[model samples]
Target: MRRRAVVFVALALALLTAAVGIWLAVAAAARDTDAAPPVSVSPSASAAPVTADDYCYVEAMIYYRVKEQELAETLLRKQGIEAGASGFATGIAARDEDELEDLRAWYLSWADARPAEPPTDGPCGGHGSDHAQMPGMPSWSALQGFAAAEHPDAEKRFAEILHAQNAGMIALVTLILEGDPHPAVAESAEAVLQQAEADQETLQGIIDAVP
Candidate 1:
């Protein structure tokens, strides 16, 4: 009887040891899994910057957007077309600096990315000087016409200018968004376009309410 009791105690001790070993092994495996970094199954997103073949793309892009922004600002301030339009134009005008900053960032990145190559592609069409001035700038006479008018006349003139300017902006925006082809430029262009869309609605409201 004594031997049997001792045998039972020994078996219990062995079983306890075995159970503890299994638990420890499971705990270690759990800790290792918890510490492991999660693996991404898909590739990370990539940002695509523009690769300019020439400087004309650069010159044309800057001039085009600047003019559009300037036009909106001037019309809003000088003509006093509508209060709501002023807000919209204000939003549009603010983008000029933002776009400029984007261009600077793009150029710096371009240079950094191609330290040895030195951007041998040169200006668009083989020369930067070949780029022409941005088209559709209102003449001095037209400027005077809008500024000189009062009330109904000024509003009418502003509406004409607003539509015309927006038409011109489309192509210029397309150029920077795709013409120069920089990620920064494209993003800025998209933002500008979004604001322009909102401005269009505002302009319509202004026309409806004031006229």
Candidate 2:
């Protein structure tokens, strides 16, 4: 009877040890899993890749047009602009409005919404800043200066700003054309480039005529 009791006690001890070892192993495994980093899986590409530069160009051009329209409208409001410059401002206002519509249409076709801010560095990721500064566009101070000036100064400033804006537009269009732009975008850019070139000549003439 004593031997049987000893044997039973030994069997119970062995079972308890086995259970504790298993529990410890399981706890260690759980800790390891908790410490492990999650594996990341990349999605397969299903469509043609679009570059940030291309996207920036489209949105930036739209911004350019809107600014141009504003400047033209301001020119019209001035009291002393020459007849020719005033006529040109009117044409610019009309043309930019039409182009704005076209760009908005193209933008809406793919983009869910327009960019809240204009890109300055030819990329889309740095849109966190609220200031819409871009090359070829007049600074706020310059615009203000133009507004305050009289006659020849205002006209000269207007001509210079517009010329710079046109140059910026042409550069962006040319950049887009050199890449794989959408057919509609390509067509519009070519038209814009031709128009900008013509406007450059006209602006140069205006600048020269300013006294």
For model 2, the stretches where C-alpha displacement exceeds 4 angstroms are 1-54, 112-131
Worst 10 contiguous positions by lDDT, candidate 1: 37-46
lDDT by residue for model 2 over 1-211, one digit each (tens)?
Answer: 9965654564454335433533332243245544322222123221334445545655666667766766666677778789888889899877876565544443433453344455544433443342154558676567656656567776788889899988877877887788776555566778988999999998888889987
Model 2, backbone clash pairs (residues 3+ apart or across chains), number: 0
- Candidate 2: worst 10 consecutive residues by lDDT? 37-46
TM per candidate = 0.49, 0.67
Tens digit of per-residue lDDT, candidate 1, span 19-129? 353333224324554432232222321245335532234344455445545555445545435565566557755765455443433333344343232233333332224
Off by over 4 Å in 1: 1-50, 53-61, 68-81, 104-136, 175-180, 208-210
Best by TM-score: 2
Error of 2 at 67 (Å): 0.7
